[model samples]
Target chain A: MANPLEATVLVLGEQSEIFLGLLKKHFSTIYQLAHIENKEEFLKDNGAEIIAVATSNNVGMSKEMIDALPKLQIIASFGVGYDSIDVDYAKQRGIQVTNTPNVLNDCVADTAMMLTYAVARQLIQANTYVKKGQWTSSFPLTTSLSKKVCGILGMGNIGEAIAKRAEAAGMEIIYHNRTQKNHVDYQYIATLEELAKQADFLILALPSTGETQHIINANILDKMKPSAYLINIARGSVVDEKALVESLKNRQIAGAGLDVFETEPCTESPLFEMENVVLTPHYASGTHETRLAMAELVCENLIHFFNKEPLVTPL
Target chain B: MANPLEATVLVLGEQSEIFLGLLKKHFSTIYQLAHIENKEEFLKDNGAEIIAVATSNNVGMSKEMIDALPKLQIIASFGVGYDSIDVDYAKQRGIQVTNTPNVLNDCVADTAMMLTYAVARQLIQANTYVKKGQWTSSFPLTTSLSKKVCGILGMGNIGEAIAKRAEAAGMEIIYHNRTQKNHVDYQYIATLEELAKQADFLILALPSTGETQHIINANILDKMKPSAYLINIARGSVVDEKALVESLKNRQIAGAGLDVFETEPCTESPLFEMENVVLTPHYASGTHETRLAMAELVCENLIHFFNKEPLVTPL
Candidate 1:
């Protein structure tokens, strides 16, 4: 006989209203715990079989919250990055943890390339200059892309996408991944320090993990080419924010394009005052279509968990 | 025997100093005609073999000025768009016209993708939102490129580059060019009208010529999907400015990304006031390495002309 259709779901993350509408269709009664500051009260009131969380630089679920969820059978994350969630702890409790991946590869990769162009050509600064009416009679001659070495930290799906775009821009791709990415085609250095030494533009597209945190600290930055440009589309903790600000101030690196930060709504980073940096608010996959797809995948995972089928992207 | 260098190259463009340096090595002397008012005086002094015109959107050599340079053998334009130089009149005079081509393919293509991302994701507006300190959070989801049809007009070298990047972004590439491009294997349509009908994002990478001017008028835009976006890395004259402004205002098109303009320093255009549109100051080939490559190519072309060798990139 088939299992009874009586699984409760807890939607922990804030998402587009369109996504919330879709969730309501599958669940008997959707418990939106997004704005619920006292998550304990909400958790106690409405029991949940599956928990869904949207990953962001700010406001992630705590370890304590995971332990307290007695009825939580699965935790489905809205994005590929599940650094905020304790996957090991969830696995120990026999709770499946799943994330929306592969779907976000292109979206995240596209944004990384966007940031590269923005920094390489100073697109944002030029836009500001023209809008400010500083372009009295001439267009300023900005930076170029040809002949630059694009250094990638992670050679995953998104990092490879960035590499392809960089190759199109006449840049040579050099990378440092956790392990050999099964291809010996591109130039690969054993360490980040070695990769930084030869690169004209270094990009961070790695996932956030305990081993990867503060990988781009002052020591690594010191090994980078003097005229190099840095781009971080990966986790903020992967780069030391204070060291980056100092490097920008000192002109050790030519410029930077940053999307994610150690703390989001990153209103207080000293890097803000510098003209050489291009800042984006953790919007790698914040586009309408991509986010909606992520939401849909999370819903699918939830439905699959209740149906006793394997999750599409389970950890 | 090779003839001694006799041409007094009168460079009538701002930011021609580097090009002038290269020209001086081959020519007798170089004149930097910075302003339009000095045209008559500069032309009178330099009765030369060629009048190499360097025109950006802001700096253009007029037809009246060309009529004065009787000894001008060629108009070796600095960049691709020769709309500034009267190519038809030059052709009539048997003057060989040349533009630096193939060199700017990657750079311009990179800019096309940049503008596409900027407009589709509202990067500039988001930048403003963050800078104004109003972005305590991300806004409701808007646009994205995943699974959308990117309609490219004029599938020339730069267009192909843009197509590759867009395809990498998971957008389906549908292009319309005068003659089908032999290089790329992308899907091609015979007409702009048909291509625009299916596109979710229409990228204008066409040249500005008599036959091509105002190609993206109200009729073409009306055929586009209501949520479609427009990206122009080509000359601004190719688009009917007024029609675009109206389409954006009425929300007939979702937004636009304009790098070129019919009139630059375009402070008064309705497009400028719209938050939906992303504007760039024609920094398509604005990378440092690309600009230097373009400069070197210009020098080589000038040297080849004087030496009576076959032109490297003949117009």
Candidate 2:
């Protein structure tokens, strides 16, 4: 059913089946390049025909990959974070870049709150103890997360969402970011270290950026109270993994709840052996409903680009 | 080392070390009956001089135990729920009863909200997969908890606290209680079954009583949406463990988060092996700060009773 008039779309990496099915309806040729075993050769064979690049945040556009597809007109990514995509290079080439935003704020903020409670309550350890029949002999008390100060690292849309949730749970809200957020009534601490000092739980929710890199390293970790917890739902690049491991190992801080890691597929880490840490794969916004919405938005961005309509959410 | 004028208090069961330390400061003749090898012989040996009985909710005053303590003046319990204590028998014997309340509402409600998120997101399963390195291959998306109806089984203080937290997490609040709550705007579903049918999460926070025992039995569980979650932070006896097990096993309901069990020190149960259930071994109110506050209140009640002053929280 090649329409011949419709443009070609080159899916740069892994895309959900639902997204592919929807994209196929709009475009004449939708070649998922990842499905091909020889993707490098496949891209070279089809590079001349690829008018657009379809990918997710994880498989972001790079200079070399974009250079291969000289005819690339647009890049539609499937997440809020366009840090992975080479947006500057695409803009220089007169290519339009779009992303799915505002849609994932709810689920990601839910995860941040979930992690905050999970770590503070020692939930995973408590579950393990009950499963192992240790409660029959002894049970230890955990710290209460309610009525404590929750320091958010970023005061973006997601951070505001988390604050609303935390405040409703009876926790005081404080935040540290590059600049103060207007409209929010929460207390603002200028420095990350000061925010760490005031909080019982320090939650990281900032985007991955050069300026924000290692924002929570040893210096900031040391400033945190020994009774406090660390929760990261944002990118792992914001935290110094080695420093966090050392701090957790030495009991410099209480514990952590991590959904992302410094490296993907974190097969080996000292954190895995620690009882205090609650770890999850990079799936903070990975909800059945939210992911489908994001996938649809990804398709919509591309379709709008082809239809000469204004992009729904252009980066 | 002993205050001769102080009342002789009989310690009924094993107490926490922190609670014991605080109790020892006020009372002179604190005879810990649990330390005795033969409790029957010990009661017979030294039951006459016991002016007051100091115990927790688990080793509550029974009719038989009350009959033995002919000189008992007051019973100071260490937890909010005095369901285990024979209040009627105590009243008949003119023995005053006091319990710790209000101090644990925040932590207990936090547990309710935590359980809600844990079960809905399949948090425990997600953590296991990431820890086991299965994330390297694949990870499935979880269900979103936001924008769902959270049905609180009882609109008591703890349930209200849970409502506030759930609302902050972007959930609609529905409630089923004996009567409608005043000063709140949340929807009220008259029947428990109706509430269960409308809810995405049904959290149990009702006090355990003769009227409430097995309140969430088969019929109510069956009325619930198959995709909904059950969160029990109240007494475990309210839920029929056997019926819940059956529903979960057959996938009649999606999942459950249980903080208490019918028989604690539950050494054996099919629940321990279930993937969809998150068990926490009666640790809902197990927070260091809250327990300390509860412990302090227990001591204060005894002190007030001995001083011929009014009890702080009399039942």
TM-scores for every predicted model: 0.91, 0.94
At residue B143, give the lDDT of candidate 2. 85
Query: On residues B253-286, what C-alpha lDDT tens digit does candidate 2 reach at each position?
Result: 9999999999987778898899888889787778
DockQ of 1: 0.56
**Fnat of each candidate:** 0.59, 0.71
Q: Look at candidate 2 and give me any clashing residue pairs.
A: none
Predicted structure 2: lDDT? 0.87
DockQ for the candidates, in order: 0.56, 0.66
Compared with the true structure, all predictions reach lDDT values of: 0.77, 0.87
Please state what fraction of the native interface contacts candidate 1 reproduces. Answer: 0.59
Q: Positional deviation of A178 in candidate 2, in angstroms?
A: 0.5
